[model samples]
Target chain A: MTLIETILSVGFVAQALRVTVPYALAALGGTLAERAGVVSLALEGMLLFGAFTATLGSALGGPALGALCGIVGGLLVAAVYELIVVRWRADQVVCAIAINLLVLGLTRTLLVLVWGSASSSPRVPGLGSTGTWAFVAAAAVLALALSELVRRTPWGLRLRAAGERPDALASLGVDVERVRWGAVLASGALAGLGGAWLALDVGGFSDAMSSGRGYIALAAVVSGKWRPLGATAACLLFGVAGALELNLQAEATSLPRELVQMLPYVVTLIAVSSVARGARAPSALGQPLG
Target chain B: MSWDRGDSGASASSSHGGAWTALYVTLVALLVALLAASLLVIAFDESPARVFALVVAHTLGEPYGAGQALFRATTLVFTGLSVALAHRAGLFNVGAEGQLVAGSFACAALGAALPAGTPAVLALPAVLLAAAAAGGAVGAIPGVLRARFGAHEVITTIMLNFVVSGAVLFVARTWLFAPETIHTRAVVPGATIPALGLGGSAVSWAAVLALACALGVTWLLTRSRFGFELRAVGQNPDAARAGGVNVGRMTVIAMAAAGALAGLAGSGTVLGYKHYFEKGLGADAGFTGIAVALLARGNPLAVLPAALLFALLAEGGLAAGARVPREIVDVMLAVIVIVLAVAAAETRRVRASAGDGA
Candidate 1:
């Protein structure tokens, strides 16, 4: 087949959509948390927890139940993060880093205990093709809803206020802490869902399976300037790059596989640098709330 | 911006009653982390107290175990110092992993390529210096970007990590690939740092090098003119710039210094232990350095003890792997960091309030 024809194949499009789903969801989640003035570096940890729990739950119950379990797992970690970061006002970046490490270790240990392996879990029932499509649809809806929530809704205004001017929100009798807590929890849930998609698509969990997608999502957050739709577009751009890599690999092209594998990250680095000047973060990003 | 209002105050008061408070907070956090870790042990049907006793005995009680712990601490000290130095200069060096990779690769390449019969003294220092230079070059990429473009160091550093990892893999496969093996060729004997005779353990003189580096960093930060400017930039870049301390130059220098330290960590692991460039070697040491630095609260001297504590956990984790999953130690480390961060925040809040009252 010609190169153009190969690139335009339906299989490539499906694969690109699948790759885009996790990045889009996670980036949106990061946007939510950061928009509320909290750094969400724990997206990586949350993704792992979600993937592990989803796999376990699918093995025990069903795919739907597994997804729910994923959210719960993420919430558990988020609760600890909120306690440390929000209540005690710890360094957000430090707490996020700790959470990532904790989740990585915790999940690996749990995998060994439950599945008798430290690297991966047994294959479980996954979301079938139809269910996968449903998930994609759900993600799209989530992006739209989140954009509206951040831009139009009263809650969105309050959330932005919490991030931008917490003191002002506090003086007006709105609990900035509570708003931030909600945003953080919501971010965890979304990141967990992203992770669930990863496991459910593969029907199992692998060590560091999320790899650096969480960081990529963070990059998308920056490149998209912390807007939901913009972040989604950035994720799709990354997804296209990922799809192109797969196509190149399949075509047995002369380009080295390692270089192809590096495409998405290299693109992200370049995009982030170029856009760094224009991407303004929340006013209180990384700040401990008083 | 208001969040940092508490930092200056806390730093000022820390001089008076700060040491004790910091120690107390660290102790409490360590206890809390241990307790939380014990709960996980209980879930595994293991007695936490017994497991703790075994871990302590296996890691610190025996000579060989002590040597192993010290060996691990040797590497942690370098990476920890890398993070601490950067932190003092108001830069978070999250790319230590990449820097370490570059350094080790350079060390392995130089050590292998050198004339086989070179003198130990000449070969050793040459390999180490090359490693540091390579690491510093890699680190300066993000530093220059941040200084010139106002890009966030955290994001740039993280992105560079992937870039470095990929670049290293590509280079290894194309140029340095050892026939039939994933790792590069082993280093010459003259280049390898001889292991100190410590109960026949793998512990080497590299531990002394780590100590010397720690002392050097302590002296640099405390007594040097550059150190003062770096700290000034960290505390307040605008004020430092106004006071004629070239903030941009200091940022680049601090990041290079941080990278060089991490590079030493990588080379120390390769020349002092592995003797070759292997994929995934010393991969997580950079992240562990973050834990070490946080526990040390950016104090170069304090990094020694913090590194030792973490090294103990690492050694204990391996010893206890039969009865418990080794990752539990990681969970404990994370828990300790979280607790410490919270405690540190509280201390800052109290100090800030006191300053307000005054």
Candidate 2:
């Protein structure tokens, strides 16, 4: 099949839609966090924890229970992240990496302790078609909602002020830290839901299964210019790239598979470098209050 | 754009005899990590004390264990220094993993191309230099991109890692890799660094090279005019530019130097130990190096002790696998980083407040 035809095929389109769920959700969450000036590097760890807990929760009950547990898992990681980055004023980049590493190690340890296997959990009841479709709709809706929230809401104004001008917010008798704290927890919950959906789609959790999706989501946020709907759209574009990669790997004998695997990241690099030229980050992003 | 660069060692080394305070903070951080991990151990119905004993006995009490830890530490020292230099230049380089692999590939490619009868004196330096150059080239791509195009180094460096991974795999499969293995052919004897690991261990003279590099980086960052410019840019780019420093040039040079240090990590595993390039050899060294650099607080000279500590923990993690999950060591590493960051920030706050009082 020609490249266009292959991308337009029902299977390809469906796969793209399916894969885009995690990226979109995470990207939206990242948009929210970055818009509030938090680095949100721990989004990766939050996703992993959400996946593991969702799988574990599924084993205990059903998809609904698992979904709740996933959000809790994400919140737990966020709380720790906020404590370090906000309360203690630790370096955001370092703290984010630490959170990711801790999750990687902690999950593997938990897997060994619980399942007696370090590779994967025994197959549990996944969210299946219904849950996935529901998440897809939810991601789209949340993106729109986030846009509105940032545009019209008083709390959202506080969030923007906190990121762009902390001193201004402080002078207005508002707590900048409190606004940032709210934004981070909210982002964590969104990212956790994204992770839970990932696990539910597969019916189980595997070691480091989130792989580099969290980073990819971060790229989406940057390329999307930290806007909710824009980031979600970027996620969809990446999802299409991923789908095309898989299609090419299956049909094209001349193209190397390794080259195909690098498609999304290469695309992200191009997009990010282009976007960064004129884009401005939140003024307070990654800076501790003086 | 704002970061601390983890300068715990700065105040300590500068004045008021803060070295002891820095040491105390590190010890306390380690203690905190141990205490937290011990709680997890008890939750899992294991003996923290026994696990600790196993870790000590395996990594320090036996020559084999010591040699293995040293082998790991050799690579980490190189990578830790890489991260440290980048941090000192106000850049967070996440591409050391790719840089090391690129170096290994170059080292192996040159070794395979050399005549089998080539002399050691000619082959060794050629192979080593090739490795460094390849790594530096990889490192420079991100630097150039950031300097000229306004791309963020953090994202671009990471993306380069994937690009490098794909390119390396393609090249290896076509002309380099041995049949059915993800490794390249062994280098000719002339190109191989002599091994010196104790107790049948895999370490080589790479340990000595790592130590030399540490001292060299320290000198470069402290004594050289170029180093002064780099640090000035790191502290405040606008002020440095006003002072006539080329911030862009410093950024590129610093990144290349960082890549070269990480790239030299191949000297330990590929040149000295395996005598060939292998996939997965470069994995985690960069990340673990980040942990080491943070613990060292970006002090190049202190990377030795920090890398050794991590290497010991790595070996100990495996040794304790009989009674507990070995992955706990990674958790410990993360905890150490987080705690160290908080401690460094706290110290800075205290100093800032005290200065205000003065």
Native-to-model Cα distance after best TM-score fit, residue B106 in candidate 2, in Å: 1.4
Quote the lDDT for A211 in model 1. 82
* Residue A116 local lDDT, model 2: 83
Clashes of 2: 0
Off by over 4 Å in 1: A2-4, B1-17
iRMS of candidate 2, Å? 2.1
Each model's lDDT = 0.86, 0.86
Record all residue pairs in model 1 with backbone atoms less than 3 Å apart, i.e. clashing: none
lDDT score for residue A70 of model 2 = 86
What TM-score would each prediction reach against the true structure?
A: 0.96, 0.96
Could you give candidate 2's per-residue lDDT for residues A66-176 as a string of tens digits?
Answer: 888888888889899999998888878889989999999999999988898989999988886778778888888899999999879997788888889998889999988
Error of 2 at A68 (Å): 2.0
